[model samples]
Target: MKKIMLIATLLSILVEGYAQEKCDTVFVRASTENGIIEGFEKAGVRIFRGIPYAQPPVGELRWREPQPVKNWGGVKKTVQFGPRAMQLPVFSDMRFRSNGMSEDCLYLNVWTPSKNYREKLPVLVYFYGGGFIAGDGSEYRYDGESMARQGIIAVTINYRLGIFGFFSHPELTRESPHRASGNYGLLDQAAALQWVKRNIARFGGDPGKITIGGESAGSFSVSAQMASPLSRHLIAGAIGESGSLLGFREMLSLAEAENRGLLFQKAVGAGNLNDLRTLPADRLLKMTQRKDVPSFGVIVDGYFFPEKPETIFSKGKQAHVPLLVGWNSMEGHYKALLGNEEVTVENYEKAVRQRYPDIAEGLLKVYKANSDEEVAQVATDLAGDMFIGYGTWNWSDIHAQTGDKKVYRYYFVHPRPGYKNAKTGDDPLIKGAVHSAEIEYVLGNLPVNDVYDWQSEDYFVSTLSQLFFAHFIKKGNPNGFGVPVWLPVRPNQPADVMIIGSNTRLQKEQHRDRYLYLRNVHF
Candidate 1:
């Protein structure tokens, strides 16, 4: 009887402990339109990583718009980051925490502040930039935790890349219900937006207050979304950094895109769509390295865009949402514009004249050099304009003109600290905000990347910058009582912009004439 009593008591204690633990620890769960998902909690934020927003585009689905993800019967655990889109390590700066690389990379990560699934917060959906060739949402620099802490729901997403994402051919176009090919990457973005609309409310985000943002190719994508009829209605606001389609390259027509795809087929010795589809992902990715593989850029597929983006903007048919857009201080390096020649006044003038023969005098006047010493400064401006400046500035110009909604412009001028190691690449950096330098600051992620020695000024900049972003996200305007006063681009007056740096302040657009001249000159 004593032994039986002791054994029964032990069993009772064990059962009580298990029941107590089960009651004490509450797991976070949220239901989507498709199914229920389980996410982890960290530092007061509920994180759902690697949630499938669409089906993996493999085999027959290659080069097609993302398909809907299949619903699961049980709660899906979203723990690990999905594989990065198929890509080569083209950039040295890229560092990822994802599982690896694969064609099955259509995933998105969400960071939300609400512990319960009932609080509807504003949503910020960010896209990673890689010239549309490479980039992943799992990059440490773009982590959404910081933004989530600021009372907003932040999400980062992955889309297809390189040949698998953008390839176009006659056979592929013929099979499409829309009679279009290419731009599957952009279509993936639209599809993701649709998914968010259907499911974000379940994740504690308001469907109406969504802002789409990105840098470089991602920035160009925001502009593309604004022009795309399928996506424009989904966009409530926009944020573009460093690039847009309107500046330099024009969109390729569907037929032109298909012709390039045909060339790709001939170069790869593939006869038809079936032959290309049967090729392994590795084989298709390897072809991207060859010179004969025609480069695929954003094209005017009739489904994505009714016409060219430029034409859409000109006619004021693009999305009439409030826009916060700008580029960095140095989008292009001096060497790119100077070529083999030194930064001499004579060389600078010659280069300008050669490039803009018809508008040399106007170009020279806008990009004026006071002395030989000032050549670098003038050249930097000229070079940046040539690369991403003209396009970005042109975008703000058109939006401010026709959108009627407030447009806030900015110039990211703060450069990163000089590297501690002379061997590191960012040490010999120019005295301007290098391309993508503002990312860490904007996302409040200075601590994650130890590439450079961060200073107090960096933190100060980040605090202000993120506040501006958060403010804009919470409310359409980026200004409030506590935040620095940010004014919109004044109509008919000189275009004004907030200089986001150590000393954050509002200022009028500098060298507006130069951008204007380049706009016409490029035309």
Candidate 2:
């Protein structure tokens, strides 16, 4: 009888301990292709952070393509963010809650509002933009919790950056089974998408309904991924915010890229690929910061790109999925026009004539400015084109003309409310939406960034934009109930992009002549 009483007492202790533990923490879980991962719950969302999507690219793997993640035996606790890719903190606005930086950074995070494995939500995987030099998926401005609440699964991923990601070398290419060296970053992105395809279904994400989107380099990456044969089947639709390697930038050939790699090796006094690979990751990161360092950005590596990006797009060889792309109003500010010259009609004209000496007369027709005010406006417009407008426009135009599906284009014109310049200590009287200003708003994350004195109007703008984007993710079209009617860019009618700003409407594309001039005559 005493022994039976003791057993009852032990059972009571076990029950009490279990109750206490359950109250202390809540655990949510997902079974991935690699392993079961446990996450924590917050705000009606189950968030899994720092899930490794690729084998760490260290030692002999630095310049190689990303390999598959290894299967784990037990449930991996993915409650904390992983180390960010090796990079310098270039943007003051970028913040992180990750452990720190390292080369083992091919990690992706997810946010899901699914109650069980039976629910399948549309997935939106966003890549951060940082000129391919620096960025973290853990930035507060890109939090996916709110997006999950909207009944969509959100994902953010990290890839190798800068030289560590884009470097090309003759020795490295020879060592590659695919005879490719550069574009490791692009390959990393493709691997991440492949991971999404094979593993996201377990997290209540629809593997067939994944939409890839980003701003700046991330936009460039989306374009690259769409162009690459490796990532074609993984994408359902695409959203490019404001840049592509082919849109406004030059891409080095494999040979040129290898030469640049050679120059970097010479400057750094590395004898060979073996020597370079042995150097500390920080050492390589520091070399990328040098102004004189040859930057071999996106290249036509034989493995990643079967052909040039433009050639692929021109022949309708890219992914035939629906595309939604756009840029800000003032992609390049007035300062980009003035440069060293004073803001005068005479100086502006002189600069224009110098830039377009061969066609100065014809160029002035499109960029006509008789007064100083007119000059600033014209200069601002041209600078915007030179920065990102023309390239993004070129992408949308080509895709609309060639792709199997219709294309949706937009021009974001909402300027950030003028606030005291954080650096100058006075209001700069900001008047235009410069590059990357729409990211937070479109992602439904305006509250995450308080750098500007956002008004109710700003929130209104955010709500409408997010709705449009969410609709696009859920359905192929951004048009839906209670939003402004949006029409696709027709094959014949090139203009008619949706204008999203203080007053949202469908405005006919105005500077058609100027864009044509820039496309054909100017640059």
Candidate 3:
């Protein structure tokens, strides 16, 4: 009888533990100011979704900065993803699956590795890329489980995008403390990071060891955060992929960005901000599809950000932190589709003269192509180099020159698994590691049906790359178990940029010589 009682007690305790473990599998509710948030967990990760970081930016809050998340009552359901921010239709059936769109979209997602409730692991927060208009953290590709399993607490957030995220008008500016105009999305990012600082510890994450990272627009945000006083002390290090400090011109201020917004309003026949706001959510989304211009994205408000990110860094006004930055070798996949009909010598020369008049003559000599296709490739590669590669290189160069913190650079050259099916528009030839191609490698969650082969060189490169990133997040150095020695970048001596590929090698002139002609043009 005694033995049976002991066995019964043990069984009961095991059953209770199992039930507690299953909490992560089902809809787990979390309490927040806005309400109860429910989230799902899997593979040793606790994922909370659709949790409000701030009050819904609706009605009076439109075009205004994100407001504080008000207090909530009972356990909130965060299991389902919240509505996506207003965006144009890229996917056809984008309803609840992609369809449900809302202006009240200020929610964020969090992924914690374990429920130990005391681990306090380093936190890595990601911002998605959409040219400041087209991305969400909830995208399936951005699921942070893989990253979280690597022992870092990962969080992906949704900020306002397009006009919803970046609308700036004179009226909106007058009501501000900074008198700042534009960059409300940035404000949202700051708010999310602040939320992480305040609450991540509850999820077994260290607020002090937080690292901010992103690709493209997200990378742009990382650069901006490095310079913003409002963002100081919120971040430790950074991992920027394919975007850099040199791209500040891409960010516009309230007046400038809103002028474009006004133009868009006129084109769309909306008289003023109120009308623009009142337009049906679908219409607003449709307007974003116009491709003419959109009223969104980060801007260079003197208050929130500077006219030049480099200028701030040079003046020692930027945050002093280690940086890991890189860009893809074939970044022209999208742009080449739009331009470059034929890669003929004449066409290439003409294209160069038009796009880069100052360096056309010089670039023509270095990038000689007998066939139109080759010329197109050269031009596309050059564009990739200028926009993505240049920014990355310059960020490392400039940072190495000033701060004591180490800087590292990389060039992503891993090919995807199935390139044949993924052809786009005019440029149909296999796009050797294209822009945004490295996303899967970084996140370790490539879509099974993705065009490029993940099992090829990308598999090797990505493993190392992600491991390096994990190391950087945990410790300051990017080296870890069985990894190759990553060289630190210095201002002098070719910068020792790490070429992340199947076969990693250090190359001094990864694309430097090709871009030499543009030196006088001032990148």
Candidate 4:
């Protein structure tokens, strides 16, 4: 009788423990304008993935502006990521955790630290960069969990890509209620912003405190958004890692975009927009891969962009939000300038003269190379400037001059350590921080990226960089306790750029002459 009672008591204790554990499990939920969504809580952060912000752009909706998401009846399971946007594998660095690839890809993911909507934390909406042709919100480097941990509501959104997002036709323009075609990808982003403004408060985000940020083409989108009348009022601040729409590439007029669309239609043997819409998504994507197909890109539609982005910024008509913008140390390489030739001074001069014959003398003077060793570094600088550095600098200069907001510029120079599991001689020497290298560091996601053998300094840099960004997102200024004092760019003054590396410090801008010279010369 005694043994039986003891065993029964032990079983009762076990059952009670299991029940208590079950009761402790928290299921986080939030109510949006559409409906209530249940998100999973992990390590105190509530994550909602693959929430549709707009209707799927499919069938007749192909090549059209994204439609509003309709209200659903039941509690939709937003646990898994939605399908990524339609894109070919153009970049090797891109890694997606999305459910799959499809045309129905207008979804977004959110990570919030607040337990209730009353917290009203600041929000960071980041757009991925794949030259505006490739990229997904589900990329590991773009994960918002870490940023959320820092008392932010971090969001990543997917917009259309390549032909699916940028194709424009006269038919499309005629059909549009706004009489605008092309820039559907940008339009998708704007729609997502609208959705967030209306619904983010439910997720514990302050709609009035939203900061838009991105890198490369994503950075271009930020500039475009600031200049667009539709999205400028919706953002409190802007962060651009590199590149801008102002000068990275020329924005096409509607006529040019329509002509390109016509060429694409002819190339695919589609007689009209109706036939183009009827084709399968896979076939349409494959057709875009052909060598003769004119690459679809952003257009200056009168709706999204009333005037050129440069003109808007010049006229101080863009969103005068606090701006944080910079580029990496090496956005391009000497190989881009030398091609197959060795990095020799003579070859460098010849290449410069060949590429810029009209301004060769002035260019060589600005990007001077005296010796072979000097040629490699000088050529690298010139190549980087020609590719993106000059444009980024031009953006900062123009914004500082015309806008009333403060501009904080940075120069990321911390190169990644090396691969952890590399063999004796397999690791290549990284010259400098390359383009898109600062994403993980600035997002506090160095640990999420397992490819690099991250060092203590890397973690230090990551923490420091994220702190700067977090402070910027929170208060529109990156200066805070425990971080280096970063000065802002003053109008018509020598701008001080924060050189971020093992020894992060402020340095006066040294390449203004180079950019000024490039600014005058047409390429």
Best by lDDT: 4
Give the per-residue lDDT of model 2 (tens digit) for 1-523.
9999999999999999999876866789999988899998875799999999999999999999999999999999999998889888888878787769999999999999988866778999999999998898898878898788778899999999988899999999999999988998889889999999888888888999999999999999988998899997798999999987665477788989999999999988989999999999998888877877787678988789989887888899999988988999888755665676777888887887777688777767887888776666688777888777888887888888877887899999998765435542432423677788899889999887767777899999998999888889988889897689998988756578889998999988887777676667524
Cα lDDT tens digits for candidate 1, 1-523 = 9999999999999999999866665457788777888877776898888899999999889887788999889899886899999998899999999989999999999999887768889999999999888999999889999999999999999998878788889998899988988998898889888888888988889999899999999999999999989999887899998989888786789999999999999999988889999999988899889986788878888888889898898888999999999999888776776787977899889888887687789878888988888888788887888889889988998888888789999999998886656544642425789889999898888988888788999999988888888888888888875568998987666887899998889988868777777777777
- Worst lDDT run of 10 residues, candidate 1, spans 420-429
Candidate 4 lDDT score at position 66: 89
Give lDDT for model 2. Answer: 0.86
- Which lDDT values do the candidates have, in the order given? 0.87, 0.86, 0.74, 0.90
lDDT tens digits, residue span 1-523, model 4: 9999999999999999999977776677788888878778888999999999999999988988889888887788787888999999999989899999999999999999988678899999999999988999999999999999989999999999999999899999999999999999999999999999999998888999999999998999999899999999999999999888766477799989999999988987889999999999999999988998899888898999999888899999999899999999889888887887977899999998998788899999999988887887788788887788887888888999987999999999998776678842421322788899999999999989998889899999998899999999999999998799999999877799999988999999987888888888743
Clash pairs detected, candidate 4: none
Error of 4 at 412 (Å): 0.3
- CA lDDT, candidate 3, residue 416: 57
Question: What TM-score against the true fold does each predicted structure earn?
Answer: 0.92, 0.92, 0.85, 0.94
Mark the regions of model 3 whose C-alpha exceeds 4 Å error after superposition.
1-38, 91-99, 248-253, 261-272, 288-295, 333-347, 365-377, 419-431, 447-458, 513-519
TM-score result, candidate 4: 0.94
| Pairs in steric clash, model 2 | none
* Runs in model 2 lying further than 4 Å from the true structure: 1-25, 356-360, 418-430, 521-523
Ranking by TM-score: 4, 1, 2, 3
Residue 250 in model 3: shift from native, Å? 4.4
Candidate 4 deviant stretches above 4 angstroms:
1-26, 423-430
